[model samples]
Target: MDLKSYFNQLTTKERELQFGRKAADPLRHAFDVKRVVHAGMNGEMVPPPLAQKTWQDLMHQKVQGHPTQMAYFHIPFCKTKCLYCGFFQNGTDQAAEDAYIKRLIREIEMDAALPRLSGAPIQAVFIGGGTPTSLSPENAGRLLSTIQNCLPLANDYELTLEGRIHDLVPEKMDVWFKNGVNRMSLGVQSFNTEVRRAVGRLDDREEVLRRLQTLSSYNQCSVVIDLMYGLPLQTQEVWQDDVKTLVDSGIDGADLYQLDVFEQSDLHVYIQKGKLPPAATTQEQSAMFSFGKNYLEAQGYKRLSYCHWARNNRERSLYNTQARCGTHLFPFGCGAGGHVDGLSTMLERRLPAYQAAIDQGRKPLMFLMRQSPYAPLAEVIMGQMNQSRLDLQKLIRMEPRLKGLEFLGSLWEEYGLWQDNGYLYQLTEAGQFWQVNMTQTLLESVEHLLGGSSQIHQKKVAAQG
Candidate 1:
């Protein structure tokens, strides 16, 4: 049978099972599920670029009054590429890595002088990458020092350094803490050694736990560890153990992400060639996510956001929260993505292009800038939904096009996906499981209502021109 018909049939069966005599209409649910699945299977959509003049205009307006909340630096070097990653990353070359840091610092200095960014006191700075910790201690220190010298950071600024377990040595952590980094986000996708090996992540489980213990001892910096579900060899027991261990390890926070096997990633190719096991089914993955959410909440960890849990207010994830809320994020380094004044920006993905731009005294290449009229509202909706709650009335007030979207609550309520408490709507357990899909469905519906079409408006940057 064709995919549409298959989904229709599947939805019908699900409705019968889910509600029996009280089964509501399943057509919309089926259509939404199909769209969600299709989107998940597709590759990342690169937004089209806007002209440099447009970017400059937006930056000018942004600087005049817009509050700068976050800044991000991307380090694109990794010790080894994980099987499931599709990020712009290269194998660690010490010389190339050092050179990249130098160029990054130069870019920072250049940005500091820009009239559009002058005197903007940033509340958060996120040093993320293929693996930021892959940088040597000296290079990392230099990068941090450059940021401190160039940018005006808020007094209570949040500085986060993203890394892997093996790279976060005690000495390196001390370096980070001393340099104003108050948070460390480690990618410990799984504590299962077998699962880690299968996905090209080489870390000893005992050593990882030991490092977490040591990291927890550093009261100056909060620790947030990432755990992944739906890996090839991940079992429910193993996934539960990962969550339990994280809670008991005294880490400040944990972020649970589902394994997303990109089509271009090694894991996808391995599965296609029958060289690796298939990922868990959607049902299995949903169960795993639900388990993690319930277990974490039960452990006194507050679900600050959909995927993020924190033991206290110190681990507020300021950068992520601000970025999601459509606050300005200044981008630095190759392959970093940010948004400012309604224009989504991305830096050059290639190291040579990024470095050459800096050498010529220009901002790194901006390959994409999404300046759609509907983008702001869309971002707000997506961001709020990602947080597992949405104030329908508030959204309608923000964008009148959302006036009739209240029916979405009814549909969601019928399917047990959301709770409508008459004042605001929040995602129920089922809705959180299908959050991404539901968010997409809502965005598409809003687009249709606004008579907006998803068209890429491409323009060449002045540097490229």
Candidate 2:
């Protein structure tokens, strides 16, 4: 039978019976497949020159408005590339890293001097990368020192240093803690050595555990480990074991993500060549996800957001939360992405281009403002859903444009995507599984209602130029 015929054979109730709560492909119904939206803080990039007017306008508005609370610094260097990675990064080179740090510090100093950012107290600073911890201790310290001296920080500011297990020695972490870095996001991926090796992650499981234990002893800092599901050779048993080990290891928080095989990644190449075992099927992955959710909640971990769980309240992911909530972010360094005053921006991806821009005294921004009139509503909706809850009335009230979109709540309710308890709305487990797809559906519907999606204003600017 053809694919459509096969799907048509099953009724909605029958499909529910077969797949249980979550569909095999949660975004897919019998007749249609929903497209997931990449409506994060950043979107499609327009050349920096094309965005100059908009950039200046937004900067003026930003200075006149409330100060942005978060900033992100990208360190795009890695010791070795992982098989499933698709981020901009380069292999370790000491000289190149030193050069990058010097340029980054200069960029920070320049940004700090902007009248637009004057007196804007930064509440959170996220140092993310191919691996920020890959930098030498001296460079890392210099970077931290530069942030401290150049930027205005809130008294309770959060500084998160994202790292890998192999690079996280006590000495380096000590320097970070002393420099007011209070959070660590360690990329553990999986605790199974075979699975790790299959993905080109070479850290020993025992050593990772040891490092976690040692880091946990730093009462001044919180350690959050990232775990992945649906990886090659990852079984339900292995995933369960990984979760149990993480909880028992006494880490502050954990984030669970499904493995995505990008076309440019080495993992995709291995899959194409049949050199690695197949990844878990969609059904199997859904099962693993459900199991993880239940297991972690059972272990007294509070589900802070959809994928994040914390042992206690101290592990708030300010960067992730703020970014998702459409908060203004100042992006620094090569390939960093952020949103400021409604205009999405990304820095130059190539290291040389980025350094040259800094040398010539530029912000290194690639502008790509969200064009859709409903973009702000879309952002707010997705952000709330990411936390697994939504206040329908408040959402509508927040944006006048969203008032007419309230009818979407009824449609979603009919589809069992969310439950309305008179005052508030929350996604069901199945809804949570398909939240991204649902958010996209709503945003698209809004776009369709508003004549059509707005075209990139930069194209007009380019034409005029």
Candidate 3:
């Protein structure tokens, strides 16, 4: 049960089995992780369970004093689809938007009325969507209004609205500001026209610059721009330019993403057609990652996570740290997911199915669900891993159930993962590398518990059957 040996045995087999079965079914790869996680939920074997204590704290308006924190909202509209987008979103008529909002309000009300929630102050309210700003500014205002009415918000609460460059016109910006939206995540994938066209995101760099300038003039919010590397036409030089733009623009934060070729995306078709460049080799991608990391660090931006960077640590997203745990939030509309401390729940992604559920006086709250006792433990580990930092003592205190993970303590001692200051636990640089593998370690542990393949001996088990 050595963690490293266990991972080697399990993952090596899983990969071999996956490659063997890739053409046979193409869909069952990683099905163990997928299926077991699902089956655990449906069978009610998932544990630690939902954070009732956290909710109770909220209901009593004591969340500010609690260590759990969360914020969530859903914008169910999109102007256009990106080739690689997997989240729920679709272009819809104004009527559909109106109907979605009505149901959304109901969902929010239900969450507010949940028995465990009485007066918990929300730490953050993140409104995300196909493109949240795609909704009419009026609708956006209305949605924020609903949230304010339903939840006790912290005075320094952070409200984030996901946006597209084209959507951030003066009028929209005005409405967003008035509605207490204090942060914006502009989805500007790339400024290069050719690359933008390749990915189906129509972002005008000059116009986007103008919008950012306008945003900078606002007093109430911080701005974060999203960037992606490894596009079809993107070269290392081009991506570097994009990174430079973020540094030069005075943006508060940046989320840098790597291109992932999903099986169902149009990019897959492009890959098949030989229209896209060969996928960035892992080595090349690592170089790009290092360049961005080093460059951003030199520019005085704090490296918040593997892919997230912030300026002076001022515009940090609450979700960036594991400072909070097991706080749940409700998402309304199509394809929105609701995650509580011990549970991972999502609504149906199909618009019609979700809408029909709404029309029937129900919120589409259960398309898929998983409640695990280990969720809080996983969150604590993963959250620290995200900051590329970990605190061992705080982690142990957060989940007393994990006190039995004594071997982990031994491993920490053996590996010197953290430096103990008698008061604080901080991850060493070597520990950061291990943090990147924590999820894999956790998953491999589950596989070992299930008595499955080890030593890179892969297996393919279909969930559908």
Could you give candidate 1's per-residue lDDT for residues 341-459 as a string of tens digits?
65566888898988888898766756645555677676678678878888889889987767767666776677777788888888877777767666766665565566643321111
Q: Which parts of model 3 have CA positions greater than 4 angstroms off?
A: 2-67, 320-326, 368-370, 390-438, 446-465
Model 3 shows how many backbone clashes?
A: 17
Query: How many Å off is the CA of 404 in candidate 3?
Result: 11
Considering summed lDDT, which 10 consecutive residues are worst modelled in model 2?
456-465
Model 1 residue runs over 4 Å out of place are: 1-50, 56-62, 66-68, 452-465
The number of clashing residue pairs in model 2 is: 0
Candidate scoring better on lDDT of 1 and 3: 1
Q: What is candidate 1's CA lDDT for residue 1?
A: 29
Tens-place lDDT per residue, model 3, 225-260, is 889776667788988998898888887898887555
lDDT of each: 0.74, 0.73, 0.61
- The reply for model 2, stretches above 4 Å from the true place, is 1-37, 40-50, 53-62, 65-68, 368-371, 398-407, 453-465
